[model samples]
Target: METGAEVSGQAGLAPYPVVEEVSSLLNRPADEIDASVSLGERADFSTRVSELNAKSAAGDPAAFYGQQLLLSRIYGLVTQLPEGPTAEGSIVVQEVLRQLEQATIAAEDGMLESGILDAAPAEPTAFLSWLKKLAKEHRVYKHPYYREFIRDQATADDLRHYVIQESVVDGRFDDLLAMMQVGTSGAAKMEIAENFWDEMGNGDPSQVHTHLFNQIYEVFDISPDELERSLTANALLSGNLAVLLCRYRNLYAEAVGFLGMTEWLAPDRFVQVVHAWDRLGLPDIGIVYHKLHITVDSRHAAGWFHNVVVPAAESERMRRAIARGTLWRLNSSARYLDERMPELASHR
Candidate 1:
């Protein structure tokens, strides 16, 4: 839960990488932390660090931010914490994530500068069609990471690693869906509400998606200690970005796009994951989430396009926000898959 930046280096050999100029792989930031001076030494390091994100956009940029945001702390910081004075440490961490989010959108510098998502079709149905087409053809479906790191190529531990990393996002999905419901109404509200209901297992506590996800953790014997070690920079960013999009109202439309894209992406990916689970000989109880989602998400994606995206596309502002959110998900997801490959390679 404390996988984010605030405590990333707390028990590790170093503080989070100091905005390094080079990484072990190619030209990305270097993967070194500082133990001599912990990330807790915020005041000491504050002078050199940027008030904005060290990286610019969703891929590496978001991944770095994710390394800092502890999942346990973020829930309280973003939603439950009442109006009150906040610590400077919390302030700095939140600012970094905020800036990273802004930079993600600002990189496009407005949707119009990029492509049609910036300018949606006047007719909502046409816009809906475009979103579906985008989902069908997006580059992430073709990502090398997915190809190299799939069921047939996996070991049992490799399969567990995939599940553990994915749990970063899968673990918190219902809450994210709940966040999207704020200030929403009409078909969009109904759609999200229904989706959330499904996530809740339609009033069956035994069937709640989160409960279902926990089953895998149970099967893997993934204790609290193992969970943190299992998290990677890429997985962290993927989870953090989802939290960032859903927590703030200004990012609401972006959340719609992001969540919608997730619905679009999940079913197919889950299908493969089910294969991986089976191939790895994992227990049936551990894989209910993937098996269920293989069908559920397809239905959710269709309804999302019809009820949520189509209704929201009525306004230009909403259209662009949705586009950015969707693309942000795609970009971060691709980065996550790519970055996670090397982790899997070692397991193989």
Candidate 2:
């Protein structure tokens, strides 16, 4: 089986004219190509996907086509995996394929009309209103599942599970922040760096975000050891993967857009959670994480939107990337919350 790196090299060497290239390479019937290609003797399909991903990151015109083809191949392969198409990773891949298809069509259309591609990006102030409206209708905000959870319908175990899963997701913020700094200069870099500084507790060892969160768990008498042992929900895992995908692919503006939207929406989503905790008589110290974010993240979101996302979004392609990234995050989060709601309700 070819490694992803190897397949990536091949993908760059020639444009795929048909699906048979992948089928022939994997020794699977062209019509029956499926996720099973990634298993057993053909297990190199995963590597091929990774290789195609690297090409996509390069921003070459052919890279998008390669990614579309590679993803389609992987889509087939994952569908045939032992766990089948409904598996967590498969679902993520399905969503990705849908997005990639849309992007591919948009990119082709934009290439034919240079005017649309070259039009000036929306100004930050104008963009903020659009973003706000997006947030207002975002599934994370409007979904009944999240509302129920926020209304204190969740059991203690469910709450603990949520906290631990979120910790796992939030722990990756450093990586996302670093990605945002790439190709940035002057005021943009400075603004992002400050956000990073705050996230890291402004150089204070004892006040790091992770440590503060740990303190919150301590206040609730939830054992840190148990938190570590807790399993992460698939939805959270996929959501994190989507963010990292943008980062790893060097989708800088898109990454900033996603992160900014997350920060902007944090307060609204978390305020309810904080109220629930307070009603339960959980100490203030246990809930400071959410409280602190309400103010800090709002400012951070504004800074990132104006400084990073706005400037980089100078083209239609970039604007679309930003929108895709934001929606990807929002939808994944909603799915995560929705999945957990059923489990939590079972406990009730």
Candidate 3:
């Protein structure tokens, strides 16, 4: 449970020369933020990224806003190494990530002010009811990506591109689940264990979820390097959000809400993807991943709701955190799915 301030060499997190005043960019007017921050083409973020991380820890929305790619990639580093940088570096890292999480959640909460989230229930069973209602009516389902994929209108290039975008988070799911179980116990732990076991392919390496997901990319010939390049900032934000919530124990309730939505979301989404695959004549092997998740994730979602989300909601503090986590997952995912549309169309 110890963390270190040092990043592993393979993590590609070498120190960039310190830059001053970079956090100011986050405060620029909304339209100007895009132009000023250089979301594309201007790659030199330097050590200002660290400064941003520090500021994010202080509850600055702009700070969380600017450093998602850095955050996401830092998490990728954690998964790649034999052990996470959780000693001294993790102490330093967790605080920064933890605060950044609050800032991000606060910002999203600000946006959803007076929205449907206001109706979340205080009691356990009622909260689950609220969560289900939110998931069912989530606007992301109406996403053009799903519509096209379900209707068989997506091209081979489109499906390939979609999966690559998905690799941003789905690829590291098992590791995330492991990080999630660190401080959990009793019923919650059991629920996560069940899901983790399924992810582990029920002790069969050949059937591991990550391996199954990779098979789709393997069929598409996306090298790890290619997968990295294919992901957009929005896509990385979703992944970053996952790592942020899971890496810190204070954020545990949020992690529960986040993963709850994820499990709940996947089955429906993957089912649509499968429809696209069969309709477009893609190989059965690539579609195999979706086919399996359509069943597994459905079961996982149900269990996660009952065992995890419900019990945790007993505390008002937990109720609030879980609400933030659920909305965070929903909103971050919507950002990725919505943005990828134009980005993918450009490739067609």
lDDT of each: 0.66, 0.56, 0.69
Give stretches of model 3 more than 4 Å off. 1-47, 50-66, 82-106, 115-118, 342-348
Please identify which of the two predictions, 1 or 3, would achieve the higher lDDT against the true structure: 3
The sequence of per-residue lDDT tens digits that candidate 1 reaches over residues 186-215 is 888898899999999999999999999999
TM-score on alpha carbons, each prediction? 0.76, 0.60, 0.76
Which is the leading candidate under lDDT? 3
- Give stretches of model 2 more than 4 Å off: 1-124, 217-233, 342-348
Residue-level lDDT for 95 in candidate 3? 38
Q: Which parts of model 1 have CA positions greater than 4 angstroms off?
A: 1-14, 17-52, 55-76, 79-116, 142-144, 342-348
Candidate 2: which pairs clash? 4-47, 34-76, 34-77, 35-76, 35-77, 35-78
Tens-place lDDT digits, model 2, residues 45-126: 4444444445544554344445544443444343224333232344334444445444543433333324422333376455
